[model samples]
Target: MPDTQLRPLRAFAESLRLDQVNLTERWMRAVFHDTELSDADRLTYEQLSDHIPAILEEICGALEEQDLDQVEPAIERNARKHGKLRWRQGYRIDELVRELDLFRQMLAGQIVQFSESRPFFTRRHEERARHFIDEAVSFVTLTSIREVLTERDRKIDEYTGRLERANHELTLKQRLVGDLYESRMQITRSVVHDLRNFLNVFSMALQLMSRAPAKVEAALALANRQAADMKALVDELVEYSVVLGDNHQAAVECFDLRGLFDELVASCSPAVEAKGLRLTAAFDDTLSTIVSNRLKLKQVALNLLTNAAKYTKVGQVELAMTAAGEDQWRLRVSDTGVGIGASDRERVFKEFERATGDDIPGAGLGLAIVRELTRVLGGQIRFDSNEGEGTSFEITFPVRLEAREGGEGGPA
Candidate 1:
């Protein structure tokens, strides 16, 4: 039998143990009454209420057993559930802890009310009840703190991952911007160099017109041609600046390849001859008219021929076109001039870069422009050179458009 003095404590514990569901439900209703919450938050609060009965039962058992450990699993479960759900619901840790504090306060109030209604419940019982409630609250507080820390660590990890990805993308963009800036600088230098070459030609033509009355027509023609060439260069600069990968294929047309070569040779041969250098053109028997960008091809050929004539002081400069395969053609320009050195070969194709070891009169743009045009034509260039002998450049391109046969063996 239970002692009469402890009777109230036992009876009170039994009441709470038996009526766990009603006690928890009433406490939750009172706590939630008149509280404004979002639908999601209210649903979470309702769900949490369902676990309260079991928690109250555990607390009652701990009071009977006088062992706080008996209530630990319940406290741990409640804390973990509240912590995780509130986190996902975007609630603050303090808010979740405050609700748990309210539950502890209500449990303490119920115990005090039960003791007050019974005179047999002593000061000793009251002290023990207060201590038990304090332990329960302390345990819950510790678990809530642990859960908040764990959640903080998880969020830190998530934020760290996003930051790393952003950093990588930023680095890649910086590298691309640096490369683009360097390319623009090179282009600017090349344009300035080409403009100066046009100025020199105009200056020479003016001098000739002023010196010789008989050369008036020839000087005017040279000036007109140089002016047209300068206009073309300006137009090309505009096109290149507007967009990348605009290969300018919109101007593509079918023209006689032989005719293009013949016209270019006739126009360029005089310059080479004036320098006392022989210029020869050779066309393969299988070569004929084809479909391509006529203006760009002519520009490439003219640049190559002019470059050869400018460099070569003696011996022959030759231009040749041959069928490399059924759908491939090669245009080659060989010059018996001051060839590029092995170490300087890489620099020769760069804008405003010239061959070494010679005082050549040039703006150093001819080969660079040729390289750019050849690339736009989807062609690759190869060079063979010896220091004293000569240099040969071969460009090969695949025919995208179907070819129509027209020309036979001819002096291109």
Candidate 2:
């Protein structure tokens, strides 16, 4: 590299510096077409010139020094800045490449003008000048492309993170909806089971009153009690929809336990007799009328009697009321029925479960309801059974005495 070989290239680089902004403006006008970009999207002359002057100065220094080490860092910085700006401004990759091409052409055009006008300019100077511009273009374009790709990868990761969060929220909502549906179904089944029992008892009382004209007074009294029980059941159904609360009522009313048992025996006698099972009731003379929800007690008694008669095909079923202690009493239903096995005793208390052997006509809800009723009354229920022999269920609870309510007698 002789001084003669580099002098023309150095002069061309100097001319580019003198006219850098004018060269960028000319390049912008040639490439920034109205069809490709609007005034709002087009970069200004200062932005277009970016590091061109500094780079031209470095190229001039490289002409004398023999290497581009002084310009490489500036070239990299300009490329990265151009990449980021174009990416944020929504410029296409082709548009960025075209802009670089126009800048090179503008510089080359200046080189051509210098060679044509100045007598000392030659072909070698033109070739070296083009090579310098080409090298700088390659470095800037590669760095710009790398910056653009980095930005794209960052956007993809952000989008993936957002999608995962949205999926998590959707899954949570689905689970909550499923749990709510299950809870509603359980409540519906419970209400329907309770209402069916009250309605059945009401229907039975109506039938008994219609047939027993000789005992019309007693039948009417039983019908009245059954109607009241039906009303309470309806009220509970409405309340259950609003809130799941305690099932027992605290309203105290006087009613004869013996009469309640007598009514139950009467209503269930037809069903028992149809099965050819003898049904016997023995009430203690000292067992006074109780002050409690008579309808609830009647419900439990009816459930027990019905279950006893249902399974018993031979022998008999007995309903007994016995004094248990100073403040408690026991109501027992013993039957010569198909008894439950040890494996089945606890299972029988669960909803929709029945003893294994018998295809007895039931929905397996009678004993479940009875057990719930026992709990509602602050009592406990237990049964002793010898498989294939018999079962005796005893429900023992504190007797709420009529005297506590300042009432003297049973149902008139």
Candidate 3:
């Protein structure tokens, strides 16, 4: 309060400014040795200082001018920053408190050491400096803890909301699972019924051929056609079975992602050219090697490209591959021919289903295989179609597949 009271404190504050850098270094050295503050080791020299030099300047300003208002903003700003940074570095509350307390003790020691060296420095001057340091530390400590706790509360709220939303989604997924089970059972029944019908026709043709050798030619032809159809059906079903199996992941490899997609494009190029449709492919410049099931992914791209070519009467089949997000990639196969009918979209991925009708070749298992492979490779498949314009099947998957999803112990 008195001019004499302010003089020694101001002189000490000035002296502290001169040795500010050294003071910060000493504080950091003490912090590094403290067993309770392990997280401090992760911080660089600049970070560990926690802006102590700035805070000291503020303390000195307050002491010299004998006014706390001038330095309050600067101190509080530094404190908030320090707290937020420490929280991000994964420091616990106790560790934060202990670290700051160490800085406080260091400043307290500085005050005592300075007082001992100078004859003009008295107990009153020591009291004044100590009080200023104490006041500044309190402001910083409370503000910093508030910032950390506020951040913690916000994140907790966010996680809680996410959990609630996830729970609701899980419930919907369970219901969808039940529906899928029923749908699978229906597909099984449908396949069995078709097999039975084929067998009956084959039996009738055989009977006709045996009863009357005069008409054997027509009956034999019918029997042969029936046998071929049966074989084709069995073959496709075998393929479908293998594709839907869990073994697709056994082919996981970390290879050039663009190289594989480009290779797939090349594989389908001849066919696409034969159809008089341009086979165009676009890739992100950042496309690089990725970890995933290569063979299964190749199959997906091949099937999609083939179908795109098959369905397109004119225009081009386009393949676009790019990064979808920080850790995901997107591949889209689009056609410029007759797109899938809106009503038929639901059954497009169904076993023995075809949206473009019976004009195309092969069993309707192509799309089904694509869907299963997408699932096996941890991806989502969705199509955008305008009945006459075209259909684009876009699938987004992780850039790096986890070991379990990549089939652990399988060939990489």
Predictions in order: lDDT: 0.73, 0.71, 0.83
List model 3 lDDT by residue over 224-343, tens digit each: 877776776677678777765665335557899878877887888898899888988899979798988788788888888877987899999999998998888999999998998879
Question: What would the TM-scores of all predictions be?
Answer: 0.51, 0.47, 0.51
What is the Å distance of residue 251 in model 2 from its true position? Answer: 33
TM-score of 3: 0.51
> How would you encode candidate 1's per-residue C-alpha lDDT over 1-412 as one tens digit per residue?
3566555556767978777777777766655662533322455446657556656666676677666787788768976665666666565666666666777878788778887788777778877776776787767667766777788889999999999999999999999899779878877776787778889889999999999989999999999988877776676555434324543343556766788778978998888899899988998877776766777678788878877887789998999989989887899999999888888787887755778532454446677677776766667888898887889989886655423232111111
How many clashes show up per model? 0, 0, 0
Superposed on all Cα atoms, the candidates' RMSDs to the truth, in angstroms, are 10.3, 16.1, 11.6
For candidate 3, list the clashing residue pairs, or say none.
none
* Model 1 misplaced regions, further than 4 Å: 1-18, 33-74, 113-133, 160-186, 214-412
